[model samples]
Target: MEITPIPAPQIDLLLYHIQHHPAVLDDKTKHLITTMFQKMQDITNHGDDERRELWIPADRGTIEDFGDFEEYLTEGEVSSRDEFEELWLSEYPDSIKWYKLTTTIYENTCYVFLDNKLIFEVRPVLQNNDTKDHSELAEWLLSAVDNCLTALEKGEYNAFVADNLPYSKRIGKILREDFWRIFPEEKAAYLKDITPDEMNRFFNLIQTQPPDSPAKRLPEMTHRLFLDSCRLGYAANHYAGTNTLSSMELYRSHADGRDDGLLDINEDSPEDFAAWYHDERMRSGHPWEVCRGGNSTHISLYARCDNRGWWFTLAGSSYSRSVETVKFYLALNDHGIPAFLCDGQELAAMLAGKDYIGIVPGEVIPSYCGHLFPDENIIDFMHLPYDHTGAIIEAVTWHPLDRVTFS
Candidate 1:
C-alpha cells in the first residue's frame, strides 16, 4: 500500500511537546494507536491479504470514506491498498495528536527489506525536516528523542511487535543500527547519554512528601515510583499541561452543598457501560449536588482499598464521554483515583487485590511531593476551550486534612 508521509512541522511539534509535558494522550486514543501500529506490523510481515484481515479498521476506513465502518468497508474502497495507506497516514496525526511534533525520518531508514521488495520501511515520510537543531540546540533535541522513544517503547508499538511482526523487533536495535547512523557515539552523547544532575532532577519532580516531616521522604519516594509504573504501563504520554493532576476535586459545593446532580440508573440498563458515564442519561448537563449522578442512579460501593482508593459503578447512560474526558479530570486530581465504571464487575474484580498502586507523576519526598517538570515545548498542540492553565491550579489545591495516604 502506498502511504503519504506525515508533514515535517507536525512531527517536530509532537516530539517537542512530549519531552516537556506528561499525560497528553488519553487511554482510548492510546488504544486506537496501538491497534493501528499492530495493523502496520501485520501488513509489513504478511503483505496485504486482500481478505480484509487488517485489525484497526476504524482508522483506515475513517480516512478513506470519512464515515462509520459499514459505509467504508462494505464498498470497493478496501480494494485500493494505496488509498487505505493514504487514508491511514492522513488520519493518524489527528487521532494520535501528530500535529504536535515536526521531526521526520524517511521510510527507507526505518524498515527492513527482504527479496528486493518492500517488506517494511517505517511508513514513508512526505516531509523531512522543517526545524533544524544545531550544536547549541542538540541537548534539547536529544531529550525530546529520549522522551519519544520511552513513550513508544512502552506503548502500543511494544505489544504490536511482540504479538505480530518479527521484523519490527526492539526499537533500540533499529535506533542503534540505523536511526543514529548520522552521529558517532561521542557526538551522539546528547542522544545516547544523560547527566547525574538531570537524573536527580527527574527523580525529585515525581515524588510526593508527607504533611508531617517524618513521612515526607516516603511520599517523595512513592511519587517517583508511581511515575516509573506509568512508564512501564506504556501510559507515559508527555506534553504541555500534563502535570495538572494535582488539582482535581469532586464537584462538591459548600453552604447548601449542592452540585446540580443529573443521572439515574438501576441494574437494568444496556450492557454497554455508557449508561453510567455519560451526561445524557440524567437528561441534564449538570450533576446532582449530593451524588455523582442523579438520585436515580445508586451504585453499591464494592471495595475500599487501603491505598486511598474506592470502586463503585452505576449503569444507565453515556453521552459526550471520551477516555480523554475522564482522563482530563484524573490528570487534574493529585491523589485522584482511577475510575473505570463502564467496565462493570470485571474492572471491579481486577481492583479486588490491586490496592497498592500509588498516585502518579509526583513522588513522595520527605515533606513535599516531588514532581518532575518537562522542558519547554519544542512544538505546540491545540488547546481546549477550558482554561487548561487554570485547571492545573485547580488540580493541585489539596487540603492537609483531605490528604489520604496508604502504606
Candidate 2:
C-alpha cells in the first residue's frame, strides 16, 4: 500500500515538541524521527490514493489504554501511562486537564492521539519491496546500537572481537579501564548513524576476503612467529649457564661417536647430525614448558656467515602458555635473544625495499604464498600456522643480528 501524507507544518511542530521534550532521545531515535518526517514530505509532494483511517478508542466508561494497542503499532509505542502524561504535559502545558498522548508508526502509517481523540495521522512512502517491512528494519537499527552499548558495558570483549568489528581493541580497553565516560558521545553517535548502505559495504569487505584470505592470514602467521620467538628467548636463557656446542662442534661430536663405536653408523655416512638434533629438540614438546622449569624443547645452532659474521639459530615453538609469559620474556631481554611483537604496519615498514625470505606454510605450498618469498638473503625462519587452525596469531618479522619483534 502507498503512503498517506501529512502536511509539512504539522510535521515541523511535532519535531519541535519531541526535540524539546524533557526526556532526552538518543541520536538513533532522533534520526529515525527525522527520516520519517522526510519520507512523509516526499509522499505529500507526490500524492497517492492510500488513505488510512484514524484510530478510534473504544468507549467503556474508562480511559483508553495505549498499552493494549501496542501490537498494532511499531515505533514510538507508548511505554507507560506516566511517560505519556509527562510527554503530553510538556507539549501542551496550558491544558487544564492531562490528556493521554500516544504515538506510533507502522509501515507507512503513523498514529497520534490525545486521550481517546485522534489528533494526527501520517504515512510515509516506502521505497520498494525491500523496505516493505519497515518495522523490522527500524527495530534492527535501534537494537544494533543497544546491543553494542550493552556489550561494551558488560565487558563482553569477545562479542565485538568475534564480529571483527573496527576499534575492538579500544573498546576492550575502555571497558577494562572503566573509562567509557571519558570518551566523546560522537563515537556512539557514529555507530547509530551508520546507514544500511554503509553496513553493507562493511559486510562486503569481509565477504570478499574469506576467512583464509592472506589479508586475514598474515596477522596470525606473524603471531605464531612471535610466540615462538618468545619461547626461543626463554630457552636460550635457561641454557645460558650450561655447556653448549657450536653447530660444527655438535656435528663432529656425533661423528666421533660413530668412529669410537659409541653409536652404530657406517663410515661412509654423510649426514649433518647437528641439524637433525636441533629439529628433534624443537619438535619434542610445547615451548611454554620451559618457563615452568621443565625441559626445553628448543636448540640453538651457532653458525658463522661471511658477511653477517657469527649468529645463532633460535627455533621458536608452536605453542605457548599465556600472554603473561610473553610479557615476562619481553621485560627480561637479557637472554641475548631479542624478540619484539609488532603490528602489520610496523612490520611492513621494516621490510620495505629490504631483501627478506618468507617461509610458507606446508599446506599452501605452491598455491598460497602468504607474504613470503623462498629465496631472499634475510631469512624469515618464522613458521606459518595453517589457516584453519583458528588460533589468534600476531605479526612478527626477524632479521639476523637485528632486533626482532612478534605478537
Candidate 3:
C-alpha cells in the first residue's frame, strides 16, 4: 500500500481517458462518468445553475428522493457559496461538503452525486503548486490528443487489457513496450493493482501448465509435444512474431508435417500431383508440410515489452476485443508454445461472477491437446471476479531455464 504519486498531467490523462473513451463500462461506472463531468462543471461554476432536471439513471441504482422534498424546503432558491456554507454547515457540520470549497482554491475536492446518492469524490492532489490554478487544471482535464491512440499502438490489446483497463494511458504504454515479451522476466505490474484473486488465478494456470526451458526444466521441452498432429493447428494459427510488432509473421515451419509421409498408394499421379497438392495447401492458408522438430513453441501469455516499463494499466474492452483470453492462449499453443503459462478459456473459468471475462472464446482449442494448459510453470496468476476482486500473482518456486533436467 504505497502511494506512487502520479503526476498531475498523468492523473489528468487517466481521468480523461476514463471519462471519454468509448470502452464498455459497467452500469454504475457509466453513470458515475456522466455525473463526474457535470459535477466538475457545477463545482467550477459555483453551482449557480439550478439543474432543471435531475439525471435520473435508467439502469443504475435508483434514488427514492433526488432532493425532491429538499427543493420545496429551499423554495427553489439558488444557494450561493455563502448560503451553501451557512445552511449546509448548520445542518450537517460533519459533512465533507463543508471542506469542498475551502480545502482548495477551485474546490480540488468535491462529492460526486448521482440520483442524489454520493457515488465517489474527486480529491486529486496537484503535484506542482503551479498546477493549482483553474485554467491549467481545466486544460489538463480537457486535453484530447488526435490519433494519439494510433500513436499509442504497438501490439493489439487482448482480453486482459480490456477487462483490466477501462481507459488507461498506462495500457497504451504497456502495449507499446510489450514488456512481457521477454521470457519469464518482467510483467506489466505497474499498470494495475495486484489483487489476491488475480494471484490465485495465476497459480491455477501455472500449477496445471507445463514448463518450457528445454535443457533446464525437467521432463525437458520435447519434440513429441508438437510432432503429434497439433503442429498442424499450431503452425496453422501461431504467433510468428514476438510481442513488440504490429504485423506478426505467419509461417509454417520448414519442418512442418503438412507434406510429411505422403502416401504413394493414395496418389495415382504420384510425384507431380503430390507437389501440386502441397503447393496448393500452402497457397490456400494451410501448412505445406508436416513439422517434426526445431520449431519454437514459446507461446507468450504476457510479456514485458520495453525498457520504459508500465506505470498504469489501461482499461476498456475496446483495448483488446479481437483477442480473447482463450484465443490468445490457444494461438500460442498453435504456434508451438510447448509449455505455456495459461490460456483464455481456463482463465475465463476462474473469473468471479461471469463464466468468462472480457470477450468469450469462439472456438475451443482442438482436442489433439487438452483445452486446459497442462504445462507447469515457476509462477502464474489467479484472477478474482467477485469479493475483493482483481488479479494477483501466485509464485511457486521452480528453478530457472538454465537449470538442467534431472527427472
Candidate with top TM-score is 3
TM-score of 1: 0.15
Rank order (by TM-score, best first): 3, 2, 1
Go through the candidates in order and give each one's C-alpha lDDT.
0.26, 0.30, 0.27
The residue-by-residue lDDT of candidate 2 on 35-109, one tens digit each, is 443333322121133221111111111122212334323446556666655644443333121222234455756
Error of 3 at 188 (Å): 34
Task: Spell out the clash pairs found in candidate 2.
Answer: 222-394, 223-394, 340-404, 340-405, 340-406, 341-406
TM-score of each: 0.15, 0.17, 0.19
Full candidate order by lDDT, most accurate first: 2, 3, 1
Best by lDDT: 2
Error of 3 at 4 (Å): 44
- Tens digits of lDDT, candidate 1, 63-159: 4234334455578665465665565565453332211112212333332211112222233332333242222222332333333344344554334
* Per-residue lDDT of 315 in model 3: 11
Worst 10 residues of 2 by lDDT: 168-177
Which 10 consecutive residues of model 3 have the lowest summed lDDT? 95-104
* Per-residue lDDT of 345 in model 1: 25
* Candidate that beats the other on lDDT, 1 or 3, i.e. the better one: 3
